[model samples]
Target: MLRNIVLLLLLCLIYSLEASDSDKCVTVNVNNLNDLVLKTFRPKPCMTVNINGSGKMEILSSDKFKTPLSNTPLAQVRITGGTFSIDPNFFKQYRHSLDVVTLENNNIPKLGYHVFQDLILRQLELRSNNILFLSNPFYNCSIYNLDLKHNKIDHLSDITFSYTRLFHVNLANNSISIIEPHSFPDTVITIQLSHNLLSSIGQNIFSNLFNLVLLCLAHNRLEYINFEKSDLGKLEDLDLSFNSINNLNQAGFSSLRNLKRLNLRNNHIKSISATNLQTSKLKILDISFNFFINFPHASLPESLNVIYVFGNPWNCKCLFDIEDSFSGNVVSNTMDCKLSQIVNAPICISYGGLCVDDRNNTLINAFSKEVSLYSNDCRDLLQNVIFDYEH
Candidate 1:
């Protein structure tokens, strides 16, 4: 094991050195952008072009901002610092031999409608730009991964992402409130829409995405959900934690039959029904930190291997019953554990004494004392939470 670790460290060091040596940057300004194209921009192979103190980043413009490096093989381009306003046909010339493009930590007020039209890039990242609104920008591009997180985007117009080869799209950490119908195309596989202002979404917003798998809507203002309206039959992982959801349909994601993991923690759910899990393929479930008074009456899904249920006003009597049922033995342990963690366990048997239902709703302070769970995903007790923090 020590030898393996040493070998891995050596490989990491080699890779880091190679990566550091491959970067090529040129300090650019407005006046010298046109003059430095052939002389300083394209010589052999440039991995990255760092635009310092940017004003006009239209490097591939029509008149003077023509494609500078049509001969050299450029891998990536990152424009950082200052503010920029992109124009159409920005990258009209230098489209070949480009794999990734990033524009981060800049103040971009408006994105050119067809800046990346028909480009064959692999990844396009526009992070921390503080963009307020957006519409269908990409047109017939072969880009697969797109990142637009940490912006102030407030709305999503129809076909927000044009029909392209995009697979993974990240729109997290925005103040998005309105999402027009068919905003997302059917080609996307994963979409990150966490930390937004979505109180509700139209049923057909995700209707055409048949190949989507992972979807995150955590830290939103959603109160109700009817997944049956959403035709996401192939989704596997879903995150709905840290919301204001109080009403969930008992039919339980009629279209999410292939769902393996579900997170509904840190909400205001009163009671849940397990009848929907009978026909579904859920493996991990988290319903912690809610307003559950008693465990659901119906048995959990047989395919479930792990379930998280803690930090709620659970009736000790119900947990005892569930423990007896799960262990197939009599209930003996009545001491409530402050927090619980176990492997391959049924809905956890964390004790919290009698529930509000048992005491005729007199213990108002019991709800105030309910703990909040640390889990936001079913695969692990802790998630990265990068999408939850302020961006």
Candidate 2:
């Protein structure tokens, strides 16, 4: 009876060990699983699954991830809600067709370098985040649009967008102070660098962009713009308003012959030379809120249809000439110097016959009325009278 009882206890212990082994080594057949939501999961070989995020899902399949079983990739992974921290090569083995990628409101500290190097993305939007550095995150991808607005980018290097073929790029409302001249890709057509702390534009800053159409450098601390022999042949509109530009050199705009609209408002320009508006194709010109004491009549091109010259301290001496030149024209009212003069003694509507003060008027009128009397025989008569008086 004692031997039989000891044999029964040994058999029971063997049965318990076999049950534990079978529980630890269960095969997770992933091929039949679709839209899976596991509270906690681990995967073995010969499996295919699709993950969907709900509240909190813990995945402990890091070792089995990114590894093929029998000529078949792992699984399609999709995380919709909740924060996800995916490490490098997380889903590299699977054919990733990341149609829409967004990490909005997810406070990621540092995005790993070369994380999504070989992935094909349709749209990669990381807007409204705490991303400070805007480096080459999409190194070799062909994304349609890249939106990095409302970030804390301080410096942008030239090689930042070197490899990506992005159609639209938005870098608005950042702390970007230094953009190391010509620091954009060749595929960029529309770019917004406004509302930043840029002080000056270096020469040849837009050297490589031959297809750039719209460039907004407004509302910055720019002093002057230096366009150095760039083939901006396709550039049509330019904005350089709300800055401290004193003088525009002739070479600064020699290439913008095709520009239609040019904004130089709210600047410190005293006078503009004839070489400034040499662009014959310019239709609208704004030189308002400036220190121009006179409308640059000598520099005003005949092709201009609209010109804004208000809010300047224009002297009355120069207005008479401009009014006289534009007396009977269809484009005279657009040239305004009303804000220069006081309200009561506003800019003289009519050219009062060549603007000259009373003193200048007296001298010019005296010269005009005085007759030049020619005296051919007066010299001989004066000599004869002198001879009679001496005798």
C-alpha lDDT of all candidate models, in order: 0.65, 0.55
Best by TM-score: 1
Candidate 1 Cα errors over 4 Å, as ranges: 1-44, 51-70, 328-356, 359-391
Name the lDDT of candidate 1: 0.65
| Candidate 2 residue-wise lDDT, 51-137, digit = tens | 333434243224444332323333323222333344555434442544445555433434445455666655566665556775565
> How high is the lDDT of residue 135 in model 1?
50
The TM-score values for the models, in the order shown, are 0.77, 0.60
TM-score of 1: 0.77
Candidate 1, position 209, lDDT = 81
Report how far off residue 334 is in candidate 2 (Å): 9.0
